[model samples]
Target: MTSTDELLVKEITVSRQSSGEERRLALHQIYVQVLERQPYAFERKQLAKIEADFLRNKIGVKRFLRELGHSEVYLNAFYYNSSNPKFIELCFKHFIGRAPSDQAEMRRYCDILMRQGVRDMITALLDSEDYSRHFGCFTVPHAWAEASYPSPRTFWETEVLLHELHGRRGWIVPTMVWHDLQLNCDGGSCRLPEPSLSSAPSSRTAAVISGSEALHQVLSTMGPQDLAAFAATLSTAERDKLRHLLMQSVQ
Candidate 1:
């Protein structure tokens, strides 16, 4: 048979394994997928211990997730020093595998946090009809919110939300978070807030230019005389803006 057919047959074979083996496999899958990293030696042992409890009916799914969420690795990865909104947003994404459908839904979870605690909020999500119907107890929740269903928000939030969840481990920490326009500091401790994206040039080449390197990349495409001709085409105001941007880059 073809590769696709062979792969499908293998998946079907795996699916037909005993429920106990399947559940253990699912728990292992959930650990890797949800945490987005391999578990450490001790972490693996702990997860196995918890999985034993889960399989033995000693703890329900909600309780199992609660214990996992409270573990040192989960706290370090997701919860350490995170703001309440960020933490709540992360819980919805990591556990429920979707962004909150609306501000009200996020607020409701925040309210749950204020009234009860993170434990109850997590349990409430785990016990939800949607979570049960989609993931049940054993299936790992997929992080690709937009692949299976359209995202409720305008953006998919894969970059921003994941960065928020992973924090320092993330490659980029966005300079702007909602209303907070952070001041970028230099070695001298001089603070200057970067211009908003709305103010950035709309051209594809210009949009990606954060510094002199990007500016240089754009200019590199022009011949020497073409550069002179382009400079001549710029309005006084545009030249001023360009100068300011160049200065920002060098600083």
Candidate 2:
């Protein structure tokens, strides 16, 4: 079995010239990528049947991948420990190989996960048009979208979304939400405006948030509606400055 460290050294790829054993090796890499790390011995035991079927050529990579995604073992590793939003982010990284293409795409998947459960959610992504075009059944999925992000704002979110995920799931706030909500300040702190009519913020609703971890906890678990509300608060000029700052910060 490949170590998790070795599996993550590079994206899993099956070169056009490969056959037989090389293709088998590609299967090992696929498991690492999907699980976001090496599987525990018990986890491997859970997946033994699926892996056996794949080894026997009884199923294509697509079917093998689908079973893995919907497996309870996978849910325990990636989804159960993560916040809903973080799980969605990881899903894009794991299966589709990028952050959500747009807010609409993100919201749609979130809805699927909430309404229909993991099986349907994973199925939607694997069966999507883009998956069919680039990966088909045999090709290993890679982060091809890393070269071209769909939105300028999403580029900043690449900071957290595209990197190696923390082993401790749900430990950090998602940068995807924070990117839009970042307070305009020279100091390294954050604040959010209240949805109130008075000039002063409600004592309960406002406070000085310091450090990324603190801020993440303070604003933890925002949804699609919360994002829209946050965007509405930004002035046109603030939005432009944010765009400029976000790009600069990444560089």
Candidate 3:
């Protein structure tokens, strides 16, 4: 072939390779955004169809996400398969990269589920201005576990915060199984009394300190439920200060 013809062929080959790469990247992102967890054959097939349509311009990225959010696959996995409160929690984690910061936010979504239905609840989340501002259309939203905090908590603590909002409703009340557990029981059952503190220690109690110090003392003795309740009362800034104070004490 002539030099110009050879150059044209090389250009076409490069174009095709670039196109393939872009398509692959798009498909991977779609998989994560649409089905971050395990999927059955039918769910996988539907995602595949959606991906193909997205690539062909038959659907835009926003519509693609909306469709997946409203799909039976998503509903079954996040909504029907779990508690309604849990489903609401998952929606915030998956679509907004953070947990609901307040009980009111969670209650609002639960209200949607009760009044409108699952599909509309999903629609409300995906179509919200907050989702658009944070994640845009095609990006895969994930928990902000690695997010930089002035004072960060441990990994498990972060995970706990994701689903542990206080005053949240719709979760089944847990049975008090421990009420009947014998201390010397042999069927792998045991009950340990929880610790409690009637007063703060004298060393720090005599001196006036910032509320963070007092919070640290209360937090040091808190069970899971108490800790969650305390967390619910704090603003983001107060939470950060409390975490910082706790870490300082640990060090």
Candidate 4:
């Protein structure tokens, strides 16, 4: 796995002019990096169409991942097998490359999933500012637990949760349940440290006024449903800014 520092050094992408064998190799790498599947597993006809579309350059890494997030293979492996909280937690790791800092974060995505179904839920995640800031349309997502967690316990627990906790391994505990097990004590005998605001190393301290590609794409589409889905992806401050813009437009 490439360190975030290494990704900063050289963000990787497959060239359009690469040979067929090179394209196959690139696809294999994506399967391993994004899905955590065996290197050659993509060869056996899972998501063959998406693989071909990627090979044919019909979609970028971002869109390919968006498709993967809602696809049957992914849903079966991550979503259907685990509870909703656990599914959302896995999406954070797979799509955004981190454990959700807390349950409020999980609730947001979980709500998206419940109301909008897996496709729109995935759209919100892939279109998020977090995904753009970390991976953009090029590089594969990788664990940020090493550099991002606020304290030693957070780092340790998240590393364990992301890598070790899995339903296939019969570790059926969901995200916060696993966390609570670690943080909670019998008879209220312990005072667990409050998770710090600074803990989300990848999160912005404040919302910016500039519209993201998400907003711009909505503007381009000019469709009400796209507008709504795009809006769901915004932070509260961002939504406020957007609401103000819309209100002013009508006035």
Candidate 5:
């Protein structure tokens, strides 16, 4: 028998294994092995069959994506410019379901995307007007949103203002949450009142606010002892934001 026939025979043996989950896992391995070992044999018809098998048998799209993530051929097939949107939609649906496997795979994929600066791919997928129609439903994770756009200030500026206004405690708004708030605002027209011009603060106030331009004013006005005192009272989230702002100012 030919190699293709031999592979089919091996697949049959694995499929007949006692455990259903093991059998399914084996089938996925066999499919990946066939693609890797004899890629030239994968004509359009065979590829279609492979995809169907993956959809029917693979319990977790995240696990499948993780397996496929290890294969450059697979990644290129799904994510390259001419990648198939139908297959991507299938993967997205599988991922959205609560799967520990999905979370691990997503973390891996996000890391890869971040390192490659391929945020455009994710944004394009999310921004597609037909995304909901194609995927059924979609809700982006806050981390994904933040990674796609790094400018926390732009996205969360209004949220920050609101937090300041309300005297909310221990909340450092994420950049993506900020972005969503801004996008949802009226005509991109939301403004925070100048902190200096606002009513006088109580002695117990733990935070101060200033316009983006007045950040320098706040820093220049503080002595070393006051800066240390202020830093001591800030939450971790607030401290991180302050560090980010300091880095931006220096740059």
Candidate 6:
């Protein structure tokens, strides 16, 4: 195995001795320590490997939730359905109140969170009556994490925000397209065509439309014909609105 793989094995072996809750906390601490020490060396694939191994062996789903509840990781609190709701809440409160640096670590946490059932809970929190009044005052770690992962539910929340806050203003074209076509596609693996700003308005619009349409086509090819049909049913105005929003989403 590679050195990275060996390190992951070592981490898991050390983590195996802890109780379920302790194991979860230990894993998070390991991630934090690794990132602190290596900085750029720890990338997404390594993190994913660690999580897959954790899920496969050291902790079953229930135990994972239990650990999340007991750990100091506050995101666990937002992930309310876990085994230890009260403790998770406390951790969330502590993290929110104390560690500003935790935000940068969100992308790492997001991978694991996306696998757990916490995504919906976080989404509910974001959509709650309290979110707007408090979100601005709160620190959301990284914009990319807030925009990308943690769960399918969180992704939907991001989509809602894109439509409501960004879309309404007509500034929501390329960025939205980028998210829909690229960033949100398979953990940012989707390749996008280059934008051609030098083209005339008609050509540019056509190009954008083609790229936008390709996103749906790709999704359709992924076995969700119903969604593709639903996408097709969008009215001209609705399509225009979405296109405007998505186009703004590109980088």
- Please rank every candidate by lDDT, starting with the best: 2, 4, 1, 3, 6, 5
Query: Model 2: what TM-score?
Result: 0.64
Q: Estimate each model's TM-score.
A: 0.54, 0.64, 0.52, 0.60, 0.22, 0.24
Residue 126's lDDT within candidate 2 is 94
Residue 28: error of model 6 in Å? 10
Report each candidate's C-alpha RMSD, comma-separated, in the order given. 14.1, 11.0, 15.1, 13.6, 19.1, 17.5
Q: Which candidate, 2 or 6, would have the higher lDDT against the true structure? A: 2
lDDT of 6 by residue, 160-214 (tens): 3323321121221222334443322222122344445676977666555655664
lDDT of 5 by residue, 1-251 (tens): 22211222222222222355654554454344323323344443534544454546533332333344334554444344211222222233222211112223334433434455343334433433433332322121111222222244422332232222211221122212223222122222222222354645642122232222244433333336544544554556656755554455455
After superposition, candidate 2 runs with Cα above 4 Å error: 1-19, 145-148, 167-172, 183-251
C-alpha lDDT (0 to 100) for residue 20 of candidate 6 = 57
The RMSD (Cα, Å) of candidate 4 is 13.6
Q: Score candidate 3 by lDDT.
A: 0.49
| Candidate 1 lDDT, 31-89, residue by residue in tens | 75457666888777767777787666566555667788767667676655444455666
Model 5: per-residue Cα lDDT at residue 55: 47
Better candidate by TM-score, 4 or 5: 4
Model 3 root-mean-square deviation? 15.1
- In order, candidate lDDTs are 0.52, 0.61, 0.49, 0.56, 0.33, 0.35
Whole-structure CA lDDT of model 2: 0.61
Weakest ten-residue segment in model 4 by summed lDDT: 205-214
Stretches of candidate 6 above 4 Å error? 1-14, 19-21, 24-203, 206-210, 222-225, 239-251
lDDT by residue for model 4 (52-167), tens: 88878777677787877767777766765454555666777677766666545666776787778878987898889878877777666665636665455445545654554244
Model 3 misplaced stretches (Cα beyond 4 Å): 1-20, 144-193, 197-251
Off by over 4 Å in 4: 1-11, 15-22, 39-46, 149-154, 165-172, 183-251
Candidate 3: residue 28 Cα off by (Å): 2.1
